[model samples]
Target chain A: MRTEAIDPPGISWHRVSPKYVTVRLVQWAIENLITVVVLTLPLVFVLLGWWRWPPLWLAITVPAVTLVLAVWRLLLIPRQVRAIGYAERDDDLLVRGGIFFQRTMTVPYGRMQYVDIGVGPVERGLGLCTLKLHTASPGTNASIPGLPAAEGARLREQLAARGEARLAGL
Target chain B: MTANVPEAGAPSAVPVAPDGEWLRVHPASPFVRGWVALAAIGFFFGRDFFERLLQGRPVFEQDFAGRAPWLVAGGGIVLVVTVLGFILTWYFTKYQISEGYVRVNSGFLFRQQRQARLDRVQAIDIVQPLLARIFGLAELKFEVADAGESAVKLAYLRMDVARQLRATILARAAGMVPDPARPQEAAPEAPEHPVLSVPPSRLIGSLLLSEQSFFVVVGGIASVILSAVTENRGFFFYLIPAVLGLAASYWGSFNKGYNFTAAISPDGIRLRYGLLDTQAQTLPPGRVQALKVAQSPLWRIFGWYRIQVNVAGYGAAGSNGETASRTTLLPVGKLPEVMSMLALVLPDPGTPEPGRIFAAGLSGLDSDGGFVTTPLRARFLAPLGWRRNGFATTDSALLIRSGRWWRELVVVPHQRTQSMALHQGPLARRFRVADLVLHTTAGPVSPRLTQAGLDEARSLFDAQSARARLARKRQISEQWLATVVPAPVVAPVVTPVVVPTQTPLPQQSPQQEGPQRG
Candidate 1:
């Protein structure tokens, strides 16, 4: 028995492609841009004193809050992308992600039921894909995003072969 | 033995369909299915018709005799059409049970064929609805892996034939050779030894003291009091739906747990339960992903406990609101009954002193019996339950206990543990505690040891991964009949190697320097 921490100190982690930062930024903008636009529209009228029906505090606070949340979210994307990493081990795949609420999962090759390689429209335009490993258990959420298509294929093939070799029954 | 049963290696005994040797289901299958729906429809429609007839004025007396023949003819036409529909449906549905697969070809208007590999079967259920039972028939449901739905449902086979067929399938699935020359045995069922039967008294008493009773009783009293005091009738409106919901839940549990009996046969762990519609579920050994023994606060007074399990294909049990009906292993049982059930689930308890660890998991307090408790500082986090919240492990499985009031013990075998995680929130981090969760297939029981010291959580997380890895390699194939399913390549035991380099992260474990290089 050895006393060890969950995040083993020495591991050559494969970081998601740097292009992932742009992908996340675009996704974040798409998600927050709509709310910012809609909420800011009301504030414009309030600032110009065109519509007085909405109370001054309510009109100012709503858009201000949306702007702060959007900017804060935009700022967090790069770090979150940086935090995502997956490592291929001899018998298992280690996936770690999340910035403030960090998590690392160790899924044995034998435990994987299937592997899915998904290329969304945006990721495809960037020549990138996301690889997801599904186990019998739904709780084992292991997905790696922003991989170069070629790298994704290689990982998928390697993972599938290893999974087949170590196939364990449910 | 029934004449319908085929001899081992015989091509077919029952008349084979024109299209190969596929066997047609009993003619009464559609009738049995139709009978239930018809009964429900009749009940509702008859109620309204009878009520209206009783109130209607007497204009029918003079013309009734003249119109009787016309009314009878209309009713006869409808009955003839319905019965013809049922007969046609039954005629079209056919199934072929063979060496490596069970294929079902069914449908009249639009034909559909389905085939599931015998090795992939997760469970076999022999269900006997009240109507079907009257004809001595049962339905065989095949739960296959990958797809959560029952792959093949063969309805209305004679009870004996169904049992014999089930035994054959189990034998075949276990990788037995389909020896054509060997004579087939009459009934292949390995004698089942009954393990536990919940007495009606306990079921009734347990239900009476359940959480629903507590809420209903308190809510009823409060509503009555409020309505009486305020002179308002609005409280009764809320109470109506509450009472109806509570009644439905009670009925569901009662129906499922009635006559509940568990036994171990060669085929699997057999469960016989239900009052009106009896069902016998056969869960093969090692099918269980995880199990939880739970006792609500009210149940604790009577030393009663309930058990629920997670089997791979029973994915919708929780979401469908049939958790109690489908997942319940033991509705209510004493400690001894619980122990026997545990033996069925885990033949190899892995620990020599099983009683000590299990007892600690069930009711032990303060970390006796090799159990590790949440640190004293966790008192601020969970003041009442903190003392009872702890974890213990056997060689094969890990047990986590929590909640002094609503006691629960969750067990997840090492091989079945899909993955694990350690979580530390701002509050838990300040208290130097973290939660460790072992992921398993979807089920009601979630195995989580919460509020453990940070260092302990991390260490357990690492050790758990190693144990799970080894366990996976050693896990036997689905062919339990053939023996252990250990991985083909046996590499010598080595600590899981860390990759040769490290890319620094934002947060590093400052205390992990000693174990880092090793």
Candidate 2:
């Protein structure tokens, strides 16, 4: 029961779909693994005697640096994913995220220009999507990642309806 | 309502009762563009001929006399192609004024249709390019609120028709019916009453008086003299482009600011200026989120100041190369004029002691005003403007006065503030001070207040956040005022007391009472 209480209280904070974790992890692995392979290619070639370097440290240093980065990113992925949450208020929507450099953005409903729902192949497989809210000021555009496909569509429809109504009022 | 109209095709093919009479620009628009293109081509040819002559070549005899027929044929083809392009462009571009939107369709090969909502129009500008002015034609520019990256522009209409269209659009945008019979009569005066004007002589004087122009002219002359004395032809030739570039920019600035005038209008503040090419811009009320009153260092010698505003749609409009939409309210003015312009833009200034606040923000001479000045530690960082770098707050706005040589006073309304944060670097942390930044939509306004004490910064953050939230909550949908007030309801004789359903607006928190002056 205690472990289930993952979200912040009172604000009704909504976490992204749990399937997003697997999608993100797979994406992270693919991206880092590609970089690691590309970076370690010369080292592999050198070790196999296909290529030669005068400095000789090239074989050791490149893979070592790539390995360090791969490990760091692998460690930070879950924390970064967990840090993201969003809440819908009466007049505004709030998005909070970031593991070290924290940010909380409040986007007033009246100022919303449009709402965009985007889905990628992985996200579609996981039944998740992302929502982007745009405003007149470029700095204030807020994006929420990893909502369930059904929830994302519902949110998009509601946000669009609310935007139109508020804009008409203006 | 025209659901049957296909998305892609010539609009003329499926005319569904002609949606409120589509208006095409002046017939001479293509001629204007053709003339401009021809002039450019002539300039290049003339330059080539002159360069050959300067090189001591028998250019006229060899190039023109020998190949006169070929030259004539080539010139004719070029002119024909240019005119063809202009005609195609003008033919494809047309605008339709529907009930709720003004739709402009343009482009020859790739069709582009932009529709600006009638209610969302912030302002309309009438612009005349050098060539267009000669032909008595103008372009209509619409500054539509919240339409990011896309603005509707209908170019090259007769000047009178442009004014009439602007009047019609503005009136419609403000939810007023345009009188059919008097459409052309008072429409010109609706946004064109001259409130102030800068004389041509004064404009020329200001241009020459600026230190940049003086230095450029002097430097060019000095270099020419030096090269002549040294008999260095190469050096002299090299300096020609640089000197000419400076002269051209100075001339451009002069032309852009010539005959500058400001006017009061029902829609907003109207401005008209230019020598060869004229521009008339209306900055609607409530569209201006922030303002900057600035005086460059040299302008201080003549006590001249300039004011600029962060009007919503002005900056984001795609550039038209006129330099008219620079968002300047006052390019050069005396203290009295600047003060009047200030009042015109930010009428409230959100304070009772407006004079004191304005004086402090402009001059920063008085220490007793409500402005919170930076501590002495700032002297090391800014050196010149540190003492005057301060901020003052009102119930609905924030005023920051900064700069020493090039002074600036920025006024940001609370509701317009997008976000705010306190930023402290390592040195700032050591000095126990931080910079407060208030984010705004892109424009000329500086978004930062610097070097406040830690405690003061924290208090300011808290107070500003609360005030901004409150202001946003109470924001009204309309920007204009009605002259009449509704009569108060009279309770029936049978009912002893009338019960009110809605509560009155909430009072400000006691802790957030009016701040005392420093």
Candidate 3:
């Protein structure tokens, strides 16, 4: 609720909407399910005698391993969502994420090429949007996922205007 | 200088290019494209067709003897259609350089018009493909800012005209008068003075000496042996295709860099290279975003270094949308050559004592170079390179020195830095060391100061963040011809035997203030 810009920058980190956890969980489930479906479809066809031989062990192992991985990923969805946090700095935007290999990226306002706000069908249903920020460097893959729609729009506008102003000043 | 720029749409005379005439490419332009198709056809069937005649077999009567006359007519019709297609393509393609924009109109059925604003022109390249080169023709590629996938390309101009057009367009872009003394049909002469050529012997030696070539040769030998052991006579045939493919690529790379020479023109650094197909690329000052001086492990034995750069829109798009060879500053050089190249590419490696820092960057660390090296604990992470993995900063850039056996020096100008990050892996966190990643545009120079003490990394994170911010704020235009006063030349540490590429001597101007001591 507090909108104060903290001193000793990046001290206070803003977390994405809590509902994002559920959104991510669903997305993860869908992705995993797709893998499971792709893996199992061939197995089903093979077992039904509709397809040619694929070695019995491969048919069984591929689906089984993929199902286990899908379940494992589903369990980690919450932690993955929790790891993401961003801070709006005076001259740059900082986004930090990743559970194992933790990464912290600072995208300067002046260097920003463009910013896009996207609301997918599921994200829209959840009143969430992803904020993607781009710079001239193609290496910059900085994006904030699961932001509330209003906050996402406001941030996009602010970043876009700041990007233009900074570019003009340069 | 700014006052002379004609306003958009006003057409108030800038006689840089001939006024308002849509110039068609050389009449032979269509043949260039047609020959490419012909080459493809010949490559697939020429051998078979020849073999039939050589063996005293009927050339065209094997299957079509009953209908030979009709088949011959159909083949002729097909050839005619292909020729017609190429001619139509050439007919539709026309480019006109006006006061404010370079407009290219092409495509026969689906008409397309692409214009690149002269002001927004970043760099111009004159590329000569093998066939085009054989015909003494070149293609002009114009890189415009924010024109994704649609960079205006005008192809198949007479080589002489291509170079002249490049010079004229560059002049207009730099807001300077086009050089009027240029001879109309003058042969392509190497620019006067201070041209650096990568000798063919050294080029071939360097290519063969590469680790990539080692793996390729080793793999080829291994496959050959394996096939021999397997008693498969067909395996030898496999080597034919494999070797042919590898030879083609190797030859392509060689040709791309054959007779490689870098010279200075009024435009900027002009590079001409290629054995079969020659190319001329002009990179004006301030266009290079970042630089990397790398020594492959095998190359280190010979004390050779390769310097590459990231110039937006200039390099060829590599796989994964990355830019490849287009940014090669010096593919292979010794320390002296490397240093000379660094002088041209960065001009100010951000340090007053560029030579000392550059030497330290290429080789191992000196006792008293201003570089901040990794702590003793970092030995576990970079056993051979812990002491050398460090960074130094200058007024306008941060120079990162890394590697031990194969050392690398990455120069990220403060102005060109896109983003900065501090990362720590589990091992790094345990060792109390982190990395400072300074991101520039996708280029060879992804400057990362790995295994720095945590305190140093944090300070770097904060300080570099501030430094990059300030630098971006004061960034100047990429087109520097109008504003550039000849920079004062600094004395080189080791005098290179050959003439160095004439670089725009950008002195420490009053505006680019010293990096504030935090």
Candidate 4:
């Protein structure tokens, strides 16, 4: 991995690094499973005659719709995986992502309350980790997922140290 | 099901091993089986047997062969399920204290683990469910202020353990000597400082006077009558249960209200109460952010007032474990106690005199409570009615206002006040009234002092604004002195150099410094 520190003197804004693709993919998988299950379950029930079996044409139509959706999801996954990024500027850490409705969030390091490094079973299986940043302000928490465990720990330490320094200054 | 454990070389706080005998006394656990058994009997044998008898079906007829096996199978399933539930309930329920936190680990397939820090705990309430009270056991519910969750429950702790734990946590948090270990010689005279208990008469009086209780009783009766008419049931069966429930609830309310006394010690204010499961909460005064005293029109006849405070970590009523009660330090509404409590908890806002002076100047109302302003500006809204209002102040400023419709009372600290603005709407202009908005860095503290007299309002706004600006300027100078001056001799020498920049420094200083350093 290559690390670069860019300080464009005139620009005050922060941007996240583009290497957060793994995080986006992990999140997408969790969210997509629910959608897939909800779409597929009715067809299974109909075929098994659990309640009342649907007409043959209706059964065929539902499966066809689900198949098309699955194909569409497969094609869009890579582009979404590529868009994730995070960056830290002088005053704030920025997290940027989303393909359709782009979102860029800035959290001032001075206001950070704590940092957490977590790994779930799927992420651990994939050799990935997550970093959750919390602040005193409610409803303004950000999580960066899909980094290597060592990298996640290092980033958490650096961010926590920076937060302590800023709080001491105030 | 075991997964890979992380390498144990990391320097982190060691997880304390839990201590004490693994014991539980859940009230519902033992009797819950009995209810299930009764339900099964009712669902199967009783219902089928009664229905068959009513329809004149024989016990050992030709159709009995097919039905008997199905009945036997169903009974076996019910028995197995009940026994399994009882086993799971017994195995999964346990709580223990380890180090400075209480750890509760439970659930069967989906496990839940919770740890609460003793120090962060605000209050602990023990709830005795209707069934639980019969068994002489209670559920200990902990209210932790900064715990990132609502409340945690330890099911079926012996009432003694729950009380001991509450006292232990409170003593440790407040840094007080444990009451249990106090010398025996001092115990006898301790009763001299009598516990302030509300008499039975007073408790009933308070409940009857409460608008909340009145609403409950009226609503309950209305619902019972409507249900009886709609369902076409005999009034006896339906109304009896409703009446009984209400009576029980009313008694519970009275019992909780009976011992409500807020006593102020040097440490904090302690409030103690409860009928089935008693609770005591101690809150330090400094933690309170804002205080409000409110009264409805009905309560105003009896000079009753309800006081509420915004304390950090104190959640709204139902969201936390506290049900049907406000997050109130004082439950009983009284005027004299409210005044004394305010004086004890909050800093002296200097006296009622400042508020009187400010109110008089803004209202143009005489000491006899008569309006001295012209009819166009000052029109009386109410002649006889309950007024919702109060006065507030910081150390350096005061404010007072009273109105039913467009009500406000704002006080901003002199140094903290940022800017003042005069706002005029079309209706206000017709009445020669203007609203003065005072802005503070913290937030806006605006009081529409009087709407009728535009001239007087504007003049007062100007006078207040000037005083605010002067105070702000003095504060800034003092801050500058604190930041800039250090050593005795170095201060005078460096003061002149800093003074130039304090006024306005050109951008050239940065450019000059870059070349000089190189």
Docking class of 4: incorrect
- Which residue runs of candidate 1 sit more than 4 Å off their true CA positions? A1-6, A44-53, B1-20, B36-81, B183-187, B233-238, B319-323, B377-379, B484-518
- Score candidate 1 by TM-score against the native: 0.86
Worst 10 residues of 2 chain A by lDDT: A1-10
Clashes of each: 2, 0, 1, 4
lDDT (CA) per prediction: 0.77, 0.69, 0.71, 0.49
Between candidates 1 and 2, the DockQ winner: 1
**Model 2 Cα RMSD, 1 decimal:** 12.7
Measured with C-alpha atoms, the lDDT of residue B354 in candidate 1 is 90
Query: For candidate 3, what is the lDDT?
Result: 0.71
- After aligning candidate 2 to the native by TM-score, how far in Å is the CA of B385 from where it should be? 6.7
List model 3 lDDT by residue over B329-407, tens digit each: 7777788777776667666566678787778777857333688888987688888888888988888778888887777
CA shift at B403, candidate 3, in angstroms? 1.9
Candidate 4 local lDDT, B249-301, one digit each (tens): 77877666656766654335656666654555555434333344445545556
DockQ of 4: 0.02
Clashing pairs in 4: A16-A86, A16-A87, A17-A86, B377-B452
Off by over 4 Å in 2: A1-85, A125-127, A148-170, B1-19, B37-100, B105-114, B146-150, B180-188, B191-240, B295-303, B316-325, B363-368, B372-390, B401-407, B418-439, B449-518
Docking class of 3: acceptable
TM-score of 3: 0.80
